[model samples]
Target chain A: MKILLYIILVTILLATSSARYGVVAQQSKVREYRIANEHRILEEFVTLLSIPNVASDHVNIRRNAALIIEMMRRRGLEPRLLEAGNSVPPAIYGEWKVPGATRTIILYAHYDGQPTDPKQWAGTMPWQPTLRSAALEAGGTILSMPKPGEKIDPEWRLYARSASDDKAGVMAILTAVDALKAQGIAPTSNVKFFFEGEEEAGSSHLGDIIRDQKLLEADAWLICDGPVHQSGLKQVVFGVRGDTNVDLTVYGAKRPLHSGHYGNWSPNPGLILAKLLSSMKDEAGRVTIAGWYDDVAPLGETERRAIEEAPHYDNELKTQLGLARTENAGKSLLELINEPSLNINGMSSGDVGALARNVIPTTASAVLDLRLVKGT
Target chain B: MKILLYIILVTILLATSSARYGVVAQQSKVREYRIANEHRILEEFVTLLSIPNVASDHVNIRRNAALIIEMMRRRGLEPRLLEAGNSVPPAIYGEWKVPGATRTIILYAHYDGQPTDPKQWAGTMPWQPTLRSAALEAGGTILSMPKPGEKIDPEWRLYARSASDDKAGVMAILTAVDALKAQGIAPTSNVKFFFEGEEEAGSSHLGDIIRDQKLLEADAWLICDGPVHQSGLKQVVFGVRGDTNVDLTVYGAKRPLHSGHYGNWSPNPGLILAKLLSSMKDEAGRVTIAGWYDDVAPLGETERRAIEEAPHYDNELKTQLGLARTENAGKSLLELINEPSLNINGMSSGDVGALARNVIPTTASAVLDLRLVKGT
Candidate 1:
């Protein structure tokens, strides 16, 4: 029985790798067109990035939607805004029908960017797209925008708020369409472009807009968001870990109290919160709460074999991240991501450094992000 | 043996209580004079508080010292500014000789206040002394300053940055001297006044000033700073807990990474810090570090008796603070304070609430305060 299972796992892994090779071949053609039009593509992307696209900024968000519509029109894809009502930012919709296509795939991306404090950005402003010689961490210096026909390094990073977030998704998907059209290469499937304007705002009105627009039917959705693999290798993730956010606030005294006077007696909210959060995870960084792993579905033989076949680059990643160890002692990164994970997006209590005062704060708050894999 | 120890403890408790009663009787005359000149006393205090006293503010800090010197001279005590050189803020010194006194006592307080952000002050400005019917937490409304010969409520709170800190100490000490002179009641000891102008700046030049001034010798030094008892009962404390502060910073990636893309895979500094901190304490909130409690000294017989005799108000305090439990389970607050403690003064990573972004922060930092008991 074990030998038969092993054979089946190897067969599945081989099939998956062959399919991935075909996608890579297609991507190379896409890459060629992108390289030829790097200047034009970057200029258009920079122009789109210039507008502030915070979801709450209604006027600016509409400006982003309008600009996206124009880009789609220039590509001869008739784009229209789909909105549940006037109060919400509309989703930009466009389509290209491949004759004799067997299926339709909706390319998903969002134009809206996360709210950012411009002061937190170093040297460059969030809305002004500036090119850096390399990643900022690599001591990258600011580079002037490339002149027309000037060579652009693919490794040169663009510094902007939504430079690699959802806005990058929209740019990449639309640019792929432009590349395909320019190369006279017709896709084997019908492609529908759906650019959302409020993904960063939690997509609260997404269901409403989707329901109101009856023509959004498609066989599958290709979400053009998130980052490439940390190794800079292209990857096709079949399913993303579902996510939910929880805001936790623990209370201490009703008002701030002098720490010197009531240090031991008064319960400090920061310490209390630390203890509470600590209780959720153990020394190996596994969630300790009851039923945390109880509902997790076991991986199939094929999935296990695929994970085993994946490249082992934890050492390289650890060195790049300046970490000597990982959360789980012996488990690989792929194995860990396949399970549910809890991460603290942010945590704060009182102030730190020069602004810190000797006071027991009234409250401590933390925002936790829980990521769930399939079946869990 | 237990019965004999208990009897001895009772005797020491009685002796301490009797001594406390005698001091309360002596304070009656001081309280009487304070009540009679309430308006005048408040007016002078408010005038002193109106000046910005941050130690870095050279001109204003000197103004505070000069005002204190003037106040001392008005009471027939010759005063002078004591300094190491021209660089640091000066310390105001004054001496009052009581004829035939057996001992001299030096009263210490600081005129300079901590650096404050005016924006943090609600309704009132930091340097502007504002009178309120009660504490701002109690929804107190602003009130006009009392006119000459007008009645002033003792319960009325004065709102300013340094109102209750060392400035309150300065005011109370000076008023006690005035009360003794007005009533023609001489204190048991000759009093020396030393008001520091840079205590908030960590008293770097204090030893220099003391070394240069040979007349600082006194039988006892009474420090008048910090807050009153939380229970509203007047009590005296001896041998303050020594404090040492350490700043801890944990690193994640060199740059912020999107939580969805890199979370679980990339080490989160905030989570890493939380795990590190949690390892230092246990479920009962006792420090679990290898030698955290090893250096703590056992209390003497008298100290143990005093702690036993002290009121058991933990239940009342717990109710007031909205705490269902406290550290160390059965141990009283007094017992806990007599032992060394570790507290997180402030902690921060990324941001919380509306400003919270789904990004793994590059670093997390915490200011830890180590409180050492005597002989630790």
Candidate 2:
């Protein structure tokens, strides 16, 4: 009887080990596929960039969306164009269902780019791609801050429109899938692709798309629009912060009051707004809203551990950022990058620069972007 | 012997009490003088507002500075005018000595006002001081945002350039001094005034002057620039945030690149800069710079306690702020307002608005305004 019990235990252990091995093998295949097809991904991204998909004048927005759909269909995937809103360009969705897969993952990217100006472009037109020696880069239209002890490698850059912002990312995703199919490997989990065209214009219609379609039901959602972090490490991002944009107007008198007469007695709405904003935060980067942090989600243990484990630069890297010191000192890189934030995007009051006037401005408007953490 | 001792004690106690009462009586007199002179302060503010002291247009700025100096001399104070810079306007300095005073406070105000457009002002010009009905307080160039809940009381408002800014504050200080003089009361502390003309032009030369002149020495500085808190409470501010403006350019190639050919491989500087900025701050208000907060002076117990004790709006007030929830939702008013912040004052790349082209911008630029707290 003891021998029989030992045999059963051994058998169970062997089966569990084999299953784990299979899973590891599958993950390895995915990694290998992505690595080998980097060049192919680059090519595809270049092709997409060739298309003029400027958001405001969207002559090519639909064309690019259709092209993406065609690519997906050519790979034996069922793809559809989703007209989420009246004014916005359509979203392209493609799905591959592996029979009996219990989980699903959705990939997202944007296909639109900002319009170009001919005057701003020096070597090549805004639409034409150009290559330059690293030394010539400094003279290009875009100016980069000279970093200490840093040398630019001209060969590494492919200068063009929409390359890094999102097109490259999109290409990376497609190429990654294409590589898997070429290797005769079927994905373990069902996959869905979402290509949006309105991200450049605030994604104004995205919320509606999310609510109405119910089409993107998946176990996980992956945003493929952002670039790889500076460290160039393969990242697994679990969450993103929510955002809200606000325009606040503080009204004073019906008209602009003379600063001389009303400076101390009557209120200057601009100063009032400044004082109000100042009251919301202190010198140490702590927020001052009455209940601003009451519901803030604390960093979880797993996240903290992962962040600590991630590769990071020391003082040398900090200097590259031109930062004498970090803002939220002592926090890990991951914590800072993944956390939520609030920012004053822009503020306009009266005249600015040589045109600055001392009139107590009648109206001061500020554009604020507030970012929220996943749990908070 | 015991009775004699009691008698002596009683006499000493009476003498001490009388001395204390004398000091208290003097303080009450001064307080009453200030209160009684409130109307005079308003009147002086209005008078100052009548002058056209637009900084951009030089003629009135010097005139107003001269007027301020003349007024100071009339008050038995020594006034001097110093050129801000060879190109900029002049600044006025005034000093008064109070016998036996151990402390000195520097008072700051600007004489220049913002330029006004005649087309925007209704029923009055920018330089004309008009007293409209109590229901109409806003009048000037289209710059000023009207004060909320500000009763358009003709009795309260003086319509002219520089009405509520430094002009009115300067008038208030002068009027306060006048009231004290009339009551045969003098300032308990030595007073020094630093009236600036180019403050409307960024106070560019003020820093150099502050560093060079011992004539402006004082124990503390008082900047009567911005208004009181939105709650109408009187506040004594101890510090002002310093600002640094940076124009960052992203260099791509010598010329704008066509999006089609090099989209994936080319380095688009605009996209790069945007990504760079986006990466610096996460969804939360936290900046991602390493050690950014190390140099920041933490809020002291005394300061925090004082801020907590100060009057503040709770949930109802926040609701009135038009916020469903505040940014950094759990922070105190003191914590959020006093913190250092980075603002994207403006960003330009290719075409930002309706004019969308497909060219890769050669250069992208962004204007950054960093608000510095203590240690920054």
Best by DockQ: 1
Share of the reference A-B contacts seen in candidate 2: 0.04
TM-score for predicted model 1 compared with the true structure: 0.87
Provide the TM-score, chain A, model 2: 0.72
| Every model's DockQ | 0.40, 0.03
Model 1 per-residue lDDT tens digits across residues B265-368: 77788877877777777777788889877778889999999889887888887877777877777888888878787777789998887778778888998877
Per-residue error for A332 in candidate 2, Å, reads 2.9
Best by lDDT: 1
True contacts kept of each: 0.48, 0.04
lDDT of 1 at A173: 70
Cα displacement (Å) at residue B116, model 1: 4.7
iRMS for all predictions? 2.0, 11.8
* Candidate 2, B1-376: lDDT as tens digits: 1111122222222222447676466446545654454444445555677777766666767778778888899897789887746556788888878889898887777888655567766667877666553324333233232244333322334556666655766775666566557867566678888888877556778877777787888887766666555464445555766666666676665554434322322344544455555554444445566876678787788878877887765454444433344334576445655676554433445542244333445665655545567887
Please write out the lDDT profile of model 1 over residues A1-376, one tens digit for every residue: 1111122222223222457676567546545666688888888989999999898899999999999999999998889999877768899999999889888888788999877888888999999999899878898899999898888887788888787776877777777667667768677778788999988778899999898887799998777675566676555566677777889999887777666556665677788788788888877778888998888889999899988988787888888878777777688888888888888888998778766766778788899888887777
